[model samples]
Target chain A: KDDTKKEIMKYYWTSLHTTLANYPSLPTLHERNTLYHYVISSASLFPCGDCSIVSQKLMRKYPPQIGSRKSALTWGCKIHRKFNEEFNLTVPTCDDIAASYIIGS
Target chain B: KDDTKKEIMKYYWTSLHTTLANYPSLPTLHERNTLYHYVISSASLFPCGDCSIVSQKLMRKYPPQIGSRKSALTWGCKIHRKFNEEFNLTVPTCDDIAASYIIGS
Candidate 1:
């Protein structure tokens, strides 16, 4: 059960990174707004209470970047780093984030 | 790369399953609306186009069941079975779905 729980967390974050990295180029303002809300809603609904609270606080401070796909990806990486630090984990560099999340791009 | 891609997909669905299985009891209408929109937005922004299209179609046809967390979980399992059948994969039974996704309850 612990392993499954860990796997779910791993998948959730990786899928989130994949989503942020793959937003369409030249997205409309409405689409960007949708993505922003999606992120907020996701954090609000995270299964873990402490993780949810930390995500909410981070979101309150940083907000969602809606400028472009690149901007969203960068913002996502920075937020992920903040989250990592909350767990006292070593943060991945920006380049490593890009290399890992940006597929075939 | 293929393996990583597969891993991402695996996690994505599992995380989604986890989310649906764990929605708060006595959720407000607003919270339910947010969850419904989250599912729709997630399907639209899925990394793969074909997967996105199929998810969209499934949502359009089936919509979301927000009566309770149990309802959401059951709907999620049915939809996942549909997705599985798309690739000619074996569908997990509803009992298996409950066993897999329902955590500590």
Candidate 2:
């Protein structure tokens, strides 16, 4: 179960980052709002109940930053850093995040 | 650009299927609504503009089915079948969708 959860999360996070990385550098207000809704909805509807709960709480504390592509990417990395800290995983630098998650960077 | 788009879409579809497969068999109204929002938001926000536009049109024609896990899975498979047909790819039966996408079935 734990392994399955990890694999699922891996795909989920990768897809999310890919979307953010490909976002327009200067998104329209509507686009920004749409992405914000997507992030919050994911927190509520993520497949893993425990993870969803955690994400919900975290989102309440620090909502998604969707003003621009760079801001969105940084926000995603920040939330991921928190998750990594909680799990005692290697913490990624912003550069590492860009290099790893952003395609054709 | 095309190859990158394909790779990104692969991850997006895998993550979406994983989420749907793991959705509660019988979800609350709120859960159902959340998933619907996620689907529509995904159609709007997917990184590939052309694909997102196509999905938006498809969604308008045949909205998501979120009543139950089974229904949701079937709806997802049906949409995928349409995309496959458009791309001249192999079509998957419902059983094939279950076998391939649903984990630990």
Q: TM-score of B chain for each model?
A: 0.85, 0.86
Which digits, one per residue and each the tens of the lDDT, describe model 1 over residues B1-105?
666555545655766887887787667898898888888888888777777888889989999887788788888988889987886767889888667655443
What is the lDDT, from 0 to 100, of the residue A56 in candidate 2? Answer: 80
Extract clashing residue pairs from model 2.
none
* Regions of candidate 2 where Cα sits further than 4 Å from its true position: B103-105
DockQ value of candidate 2: 0.69
Per-candidate Cα lDDT values, in order, are 0.77, 0.79
Writing each residue's lDDT as its tens digit, candidate 1 over A1-105 gives 665544544555676778887787778988897788788888887776667788889999999886788888888888989987997767889887667655444
RMSD of 2: 1.8
Question: Whole-model lDDT for model 2 versus the true structure?
Answer: 0.79
On a 0 to 100 scale, what is the lDDT of residue A91 in model 2? Answer: 84
TM-score of candidate 1 chain A against the true chain A: 0.84
